[model samples]
Target: MVAPTIQPSLPRVSPWALSSFWFGSAFHWLLLLLILMPADIERLVGSAHKGTYLGLLSGLGAVVALVLPPLVGSYSDRVGKRITFIRWGVAANVAGLLVMGFGLRAGFNVYLLGFLLVQFGNNFATAPYSALIPEYVAPAQRGRYSGVMGLLQLSGQLLGGVVGALVGTAVVPRELAFVLVAVVLGLSALVTILRVPEPPRQELPADTAPRLGWLQLFAQNAFFWVFVTRALFSLGQYSVQPFLQYYLHDVIGRFRLFGLNLGNAVTASSVMLLAIIVGGVASTLLAGQLSDRLGRKPVIFFAGSVMAAAAILLLFGPPFGGVLLLALVFGLGFGAFTSVDWALGSDAMPSRRSFGRDMGIWHVAFVAPQLAQTPQGRLLDWGNALQPNLGYTLVFGIAAAFFLLGVVLVQRVKNLK
Candidate 1:
């Protein structure tokens, strides 16, 4: 009888590395709260120009996102010192937040400058930070690890929302919120710097340099399809997000929560955040494991379907309870998507040598959607002009379409099961 063949097991990851992943993910999600700050801007600018101002702000953010991450990622790859970049990026972010706090007290242009600084700094850190995942985790374990990261991200988002809601209630000053986020970001960075071990430096032969140019990679690589799917899906989600508060306020009307009368925007936002936190915990914990067994495509497809359904439900203008139910569904979908998508992207990466660069390019998928905010805002204004809340209706419909398109396009990726 022939001896049985033994399969090689993946190397075990350190506890410190896992902890770093958790903290890094938390920082990423916490930063997402910046997107929700247009309401604060509205206080300064007024309602009529809110869309225009937001368009300009998001556009500036997009410019930073477009330029910084890949540049920093490429530089870090060359230097073989990703953590150094991360530390510098965190310091820049803290400085930017401080400037923003002062700027908000001074004028809009100053606030814009500070916000742009924050964007550049955050993206600079994120590129190298995200590239660390594949270096640390084994292919067999990427799914499980991605799940944990997703859970931490959701937890961070929940925390940020709670903080924002408290600020809305005057329980904390608005500037204090910026301080809090900065502190959290700084702490997370410190933890990552101390805990996560860097990957061994690779010394490649001069003749073996990456053959494909960056732009060529976009056309010749299958990973670009992954980028496309993520970008389109994000565009769909963002098309409505900047306008959600306005919709809740203007269209849904105000209602009381916890015996304290609150604006419809705040009440709805709080409820939705709660629903996301509750629903996301389980989905995020489970989806990655399921994707490991069932394949990434199925989990992603299911998530897209669920998200599309939630978007369609929103189009009906449901009651508050119904809205909560829809939010739960959306959270479930988003949780699963967030958990598995990173693993999927890692699986499709073109070359390990260019992980940072490729991932930075992938980061563009995220920023590209920011550009959509302008068009979406314009669409909202035009639709509302045509009919009351027509803009919101159009937004949801467009969101659903993009979700479905993402689901379909993901099927085109042949590299991963």
Candidate 2:
């Protein structure tokens, strides 16, 4: 019998590049929680149609996130440079933040426009940046690097929670917080420009087209299934995230923490976020390393199970202690999922030559959940109308269902072992 050909491994990337990439990831997560979540909540707080408005903004963002990434990523592939897109995207994000800050101060409609711009800028940066992983890291080492990225992302989330807590306690102006987030994003861009040199471009075929249509590219692709799994998992994970502050404040009611007078919803939500960060950081590090050895499927299955259980616990478990435990559990699952899922997707790439385009296509998984967020939000509102805090219960149940569905669907992936 003929033996299967063995592929040679790519060279390992430098520490500087890895660190810069991690920093960039960290900054991205930090800004997402620190600026976007709080700003959105602020916009919708007193509105009579809070759920509808939040859903509309989220849907608009989903649209931007869906459309821009693949197009920009394909463009980057054609040009053979991801860094330029990253730079411009970061700049655009900063401009969006400024617009958001001013718009928030002025009116809700203005802020909605700014929010859309932010989504465009963020998706543009992320799609190309994600493609860099395959470009820079060897396949064998993708998990380890993904773990490091996840750890940094959790750390950023932890810090963002702390900042949010401070803001909740009136220690920082929300406008100043937005400015700080923009500055951090700018600094991260600088680091990327300085330390993370773009990989040499793959020479395309002589007759290669500049862009492949999405439908053509997606047909018969196993990565599309990976994309579906990710969308379901993210939908479950994010179901509560956007509205968590309100849930804690409005449903759970104010309660003392650590004998200090921190009873506000934002503070409570931040505390829970901190718990999640701690749990996630540890699991992410371990899961990433383990996936490198055991393959991505097992880690993802385990993580998804844990996440589903956590969501269930949050719905029926005890109040304070249960909440804390559930947060930790959720974090553990989220961290593991975050670490392995990227590696899993990377393993399923259709072509290396079109990494940017393909990765952009993969990113639609993450953005597609935003489309559901509106309906989910309306669901929550509907539940609340029937009974107090019932909306949150419905949301958690739906989230659990999504997580379990993801767990089941991930088993269908036949490409990765």
Worst window of 10 by summed lDDT in candidate 1: 1-10
Per-prediction TM-score to the true structure, in the order listed: 0.91, 0.90
Residue pairs with clashing backbones, model 2: none
Q: Pairs clashing in candidate 1? A: none
Per-residue CA lDDT of model 1 for 274-370, tens digit only, reads: 6766677769869989888888889889888999999888887776667778888888988898888778877867665666777888888877788
lDDT of 2 by residue, 1-417 (tens): 322111123355553455464564455555454345544655556634566567767877899988888888777777777787888888887888788765666777778777777787778888888787776777798898888777777776777777766763367677776776777768766776777766664444444333346676666356767888999998986686777766766666754655566666666777888888889987988999999998888988888899999888776636654687789988899999988776777787766667788898888888878887788778888888889879889998899899989888888887676
Q: Superpose all Cα atoms of candidate 2 onto the true structure and report the RMSD in Å to 1 decimal.
A: 4.5
Off by over 4 Å in 1: 1-36, 204-211, 256-261
User: Residue 369, candidate 2: how far off, in angstroms?
Assistant: 0.7
- Residue 175 alpha-carbon offset, candidate 2, angstroms: 1.0
C-alpha lDDT (0 to 100) for residue 284 of candidate 1: 88
